[model samples]
Target: MKIFNLPLSESTFEKRAPFYGRLSATIEDMRGKTKLVLRLLLLFVAKHEIEATNWKIIALWGMG
Candidate 1:
């Protein structure tokens, strides 16, 4: 899933899968949510890997 990028166990991911689906009933909103999550993850990863920056991330995964 293009949902979260963190040290999450299988149980935790599966536990929240239903809620992720509940982000929206429309296909467009769901897709947007996925893309937004991925973009945020890419930014976080790039900041740490490419720029050699240190970040302490505390994430709450959901639709705003």
Candidate 2:
């Protein structure tokens, strides 16, 4: 992926440590049930809230 002319490779994405180490660690330490809740919370965003219909909209909304 390219971000502002900076190239980011697949391996960079696979390793979340540099970007989200603390949040990742917190998620990792959660119980199975808690993890499930977290996943649900993350996936439960209302479509209308984001209004993302395509990749471009999704990217713009995500960045904004």
Candidate 3:
């Protein structure tokens, strides 16, 4: 098996490394924001359901 050595410049590697690092960090930040939004949405839905059930109970009791 022949091993092929790829030529890479020091400056090119350095620039690309930092660029990829920043891109990865941005992706992580976006994921965190998405998770937070999903959690908030779930909490809001749960609260809305609870309030709806309570209103239904109140209406039934008032009618009787």
Q: For residues 1-64, could you state the per-residue lDDT of candidate 3 as single tens digits?
A: 7574333888776768877789789999999999999999999999999999999999999999
Those runs of model 2 whose alpha carbons end farther than 4 Å from true positions after fitting are 1-30, 46-49, 52-64
Across 1-64, the per-residue lDDT of candidate 2 in tens digits comes to 7544422777766675465667667677786679798778777765534555566687888999
Q: Rate the local accuracy (lDDT) of all candidates.
A: 0.69, 0.67, 0.88
Candidate 1 lDDT tens digits, 1-64: 7765643788977887777667545677878899999999999998778544222222222321
Where in model 3 is the C-alpha error above 4 Å?
A: 1-14
Better of 1 and 2 by lDDT: 1
Stretches of candidate 1 off by over 4 Å are: 1-25, 51-64
Q: Comparing candidate 1 with candidate 3, which one achieves the higher lDDT? A: 3
Which pairs clash in the backbone of model 2? none
State how far residue 2 of model 2 sits from its true place (Å): 54
Q: Indicate the residue-level lDDT of 26 in model 3.
A: 100
TM-score of each: 0.40, 0.27, 0.69
Angstrom error at residue 54, model 2? 7.7
In terms of lDDT, the best-performing candidate is 3
